[model samples]
Target: MSDTGSYNAVTWLLDRNVDEGRASKLAFTDTVSELTYGDLQKQSRRVANMLRRLGVRREERVAMIMLDTTDFPAVFLGAIRAGIVPVPLNTLLTSDQYAYVLADCRARVLFISEALLPVVKDMVGRLSDLDHVVVCGNDAHGFKKLSDELAGESDSFVTVPTHADEPAFWLYSSGSTGMPKGVRHLHSNLAATAETYASQVLGIREDDVCLSAAKLFFAYGLGNALTFPMSVGATTVLNSERPTPATMFALMNKYNPSIFFGVPTLFSAMLHDEALKHERGGTRLRICTSAGEALPESVGNAWKARFGVDILDGVGSTELLHIFLSNSPDDIKYGTSGRPVPGYKVRLVNEAGAEVSDGEVGELLVDAPSAGEGYWNQRSKSRRTFEGHWTRTGDKYVRDAEGRYTFCGRSDDMFKVSGIWVSPFEVESALITHPAVLEAAVVPEADPEGLLKPKAFVVLRADAKTQGLQEALKEHVQQKIGVWKYPRWIEVVDALPKTATGKIQRFKLRDGAR
Candidate 1:
């Protein structure tokens, strides 16, 4: 595990499990099938052999458009085992976005799931650098079948002696601001997150079972379902279908997982279900974690009251690969993102690059061991985000006297009202606390005098009356936080715009406000 010696992330994640007598342990279970640690290692080796057979060289990129199945881990780790870089794309993106990423990474091979072929089926053979297409299911539609390709290859290959600092994989950002940018992470970065956040905060053990509603395409889910569980040979439950309140509850009741990873949006929806009010049998969730967005204090408290388990709210970004500031089991704060994680440092700075005092909003910058190298094909942006060892998180936060950081809003989402800065998250948090509100988003709109004021977009509960709801919500917000921070205009909608990872796209709302 030394940085100076030969190292491969797959060697530590996949091979180490087999070497330590966990070969027969259940590694992954999907809706259709299951894979053991022994089978995962062997299949990964076969995948390495198949990639080499297809003229894919070391350091070359392979794009993965597969779903949350057992094949995902094998292909991902196999590429790392053969010293090839794998780029896992968000399956929910449009065909144009898929084309942009496939062409951007210049991936030599594309491994896609059968059901998702329609998204990029027309783009096949159109990308300049893409040479081969391999489908992971039965109907290949004239493309190479993954099972057929693996049948001809041997399940024995040597682990490439890659350097610890070598580029292992690429994760494209969710494009909350604009187009997606590829973030490069090293071989050591995977293990760094496991050792710090996974080991210290989650305290994952060998006997634990994990089920993350987040998918593998996301950085949060990649660590939660793949690296974290694999780091200790724990069992992981994978669901390919969309995660709803019913689906997630069914999986939890069936698997009896000890740990669950989810975002704030899903947690809020699950809390609204009447089924959650009744006691479900065989639910053994010991610890639950929330990321991708801040967990509302009311939602967290309500969840703990309904089911005697806390949702550890934390803050992380694609640039950092995983969470660097999180609430642990011992220290439970409902609203604030807990103190800096072990082996990481965080600071808040103003526009002039000076450190901000407590109770003042500033950008949150992190210096972590798992920080990404930089954005691919983006020099100016790379320099702007990755400054020496510090990576700007693009989030505005205020630190309390006790050193807990509370999220304000994104730097771009913050605006001034009455010459005072207004945090959209703070206002949105206040709005969602009302009885009629299900979800809320705040954006700044110019008033008649060309002055900016808060405008809110809200989704109401199923049975709530909307006749006088706006006035009721306005008065409720004024009483909760402050009178000046209430939204000047409120519009109830069916849903809010969000990224594939469940992050609200406030910039889109800003455009509509204009």
Candidate 2:
């Protein structure tokens, strides 16, 4: 290897932080521990040394099932430094789900947090390609102890020379409908995302500290909790638990972060949560961002009215890494997914593969430098999605005359009722506006003749889940939205099923388990 040949994504981020005089700056924090840029850089190098000592080769995948804790980024950055492709698995998933991904990726080493190791360790027996398991918490439980081993390793390691186009990391899709697909990203995508979205759109500053309701594993959370903040040498708050409204507010109070990233469901919960209503004094949040699911207009408006903060919602996918079409601070529309960011090009394409005009709904396509290489082991699906210079987002949207895009629903999720098209997101947004409604999901249910009609699976307020609430909710939708688009059937459940990132599983509702 040449003395100075390549730009490693990991070392570049660390060097940028050091060069900007942020060596002693707070880089990551949690309930139990905090780490600075100097600490992170040193620990990440030690992790790389540990991996090399374990005989892990360049470009080999190191899969992790970890929380949004201090160890997540250190190990992730270490993989990037060593030119190892890091595969961050969703922390909350069934053993079968973990088995599917671990088997698919054939990851050489598996690093699991301590709390989860007991349940997941048995699966290692079935994984023929897995060579070792390294636990991330205090005690390793007979497996390799990650923190203990790093303590003995040297804190100096040379960054592997990887080309710009080579694979750097892989984020598995949320798999709300089916098995997860790995979205592979190149080495250059991370830096480009920081330059375009974080710099131009969000205007992130070095003084800004970020807290994300989305975990570190999801694409949105990874950018918010790690890449975006670290790009400007900013600090990030890490929470290890699931992103309940209670947990989020606690982090906000503890960290007083300037930026809070969340999904629509959490925003909805916080708006109606009794505990948070009385305590909204000093979060110091300048602006809030929402993604992973479309932020319902009702939820967005309620959040602003309740908390005095505007939530800028946007559209992004695992393939694009982060938000490409987003609502900026100065140009936020409560109901629209704002215009494209500086370095991204957007297209609304119809079924004929032609661009749709303003006021017409079509599938959304985004072309960005931060786009992923392709899905792993799925050639045909990759060909359909990862076209040259563009990625099909699979969500349908309508563009306004001013170039603002309103999210309709997933292209596959859109249904027809009596020869007219119906967007579940539109109806779901309307359903959520009802006073008694807390959360909602709309899907198509078929009859004997195979004709489909809109059906709603709802989670009502504690007192409103009583008898006859279904008919009232149906009428509420009829009044709020189009009469024909109202749900023909309604079922009230205790909670809506969601992915680890809080995206509603509408497909589960379609299967009639509710």
Candidate 3:
């Protein structure tokens, strides 16, 4: 591999304002705990020293099971500085799910936070390769305290020289079908993703205050919160708990940030909050972004109308470790995801790997430096996902004449209904366009006549679940997309099952439809 003329992930972040000797520049929550660039450098070096002392070697996997807090970046960058790969585990995973990932990644050093200690203890026996369990808390059983180890260590450590192809982090694929697979990403790939997603697409500035609704474990959230902000000299606001609409609103009011990164579900809920709408337009919010799933056109319009700001939607995957295509703030379209980011090549291809005609639906393939090296420990699946330097994102999309990409749905979510192929995302998008529907998921349901008909699971916008509204919504779909695509059955559900990253779990809708 040739040199990309770039520093690895750790050096790239540390070089920003390291000469100034300031770490916490601004006050956080009216407290002095805010981290500055200089503080980041010192903590990262100390974490690197701690990892090296704990016998962590280059390319060895260290699993982190913690919430989004100040320690996350220190530990993550420290591992990178020490030339070790950090595998962040999803906090929401059950004992079995956590055990499987730990066993599969073969992580020798497992770090746990106090909040997640109970589940970590349940899987401790199942993880045979795990030699250490460092807890970010007070005295804990069967674990070393993380706070005591990094107290007085000198902030002077040398970064190990690592090849560009050396593993930097291991992200797991979102397992919609079965168990998730480990994805190995090189340091070069992470750096490339930071440049493309933060520089080209987000155009994030150093003075920007960034806060993300997605968690730290998800790839989208990881890039948006940590990597993207660090690429520039931006401050990231991390909330360790789950982000409810109330929590997000209070944070925005308190922090007064410029950028808010979230999924469509979060955006839609924010639009409905009267308190948020009343105070948002008076604020200085520069841009809002939606990703990890398609943003409904109605949600985009609703947010824009309320805040006088457009919500730029994008598409990305864990396999790629960052966003592939996104709508920039200056050139955003309400409904469509904009063209691919600079330095990335995107194409819609058919089953034979040939380019599809314009306006034709096919799998979205991306040729970017950000794509993962391959799936860890699964060579066959790796071959299928990574082809000839391009990563095949398993999403079906259409390219318009202007080169804008319109997401149809996941390739697996597109199924035949009455001999016509239907995209669940498209149907759900249409259903939400109706005024009464707050959220919706479309799936194939078998009719009494043994035919698969489109079914919609909907959550009413308000307490307006009157009989008049349901019939009007069914008619609205018929008028908008035509009779063939209309959902034959509509179920008013209170809530939809969602992934930890805020993606709607269509598999649950499919099962409920059946």
Best by lDDT: 1
C-alpha lDDT of residue 221 in model 2 = 89
Each candidate: RMSD to true structure?
1.0, 2.2, 2.2
Q: TM-score each candidate.
A: 0.99, 0.96, 0.95
Clashing pairs in 2: none
**lDDT tens string, model 1, 1-514?**
6869889999889889999999999999996989999999999999999999999999999999989999999999999999999999999989989999999999999999999999999987799999999999989999999999999889989999999999999999998677799999999999999999999999999999999999998999999999999999999999898988888888988889999899999999888977664645246788899999999999999889887899999988888999999999999889889989999999999999999999999999999999999999999999999999899999999999999999999999999999888999999999999988999999999999999999999998888888888889999999998888999999888999999888899989999999
Worst 10 residues of 3 by lDDT: 24-33
- Superposed by TM-score, candidate 1 places the C-alpha of residue 217 at a distance from the truth, in angstroms, of 0.9
Writing each residue's lDDT as its tens digit, candidate 3 over 1-37 gives 3575434568766645565443656312212246677
Candidate 2 structure quality by residue, lDDT tens digits, 318-380 = 999999989988998887899998999999999999998999889998889899989999999
Off by over 4 Å in 3: 1-7, 20-32, 274-277
Whole-model lDDT, model 3: 0.81
Model 1 C-alpha lDDT versus the unseen true structure: 0.93
Please report the candidate that would top TM-score against the real structure. 1
Worst 10 residues of 1 by lDDT: 274-283
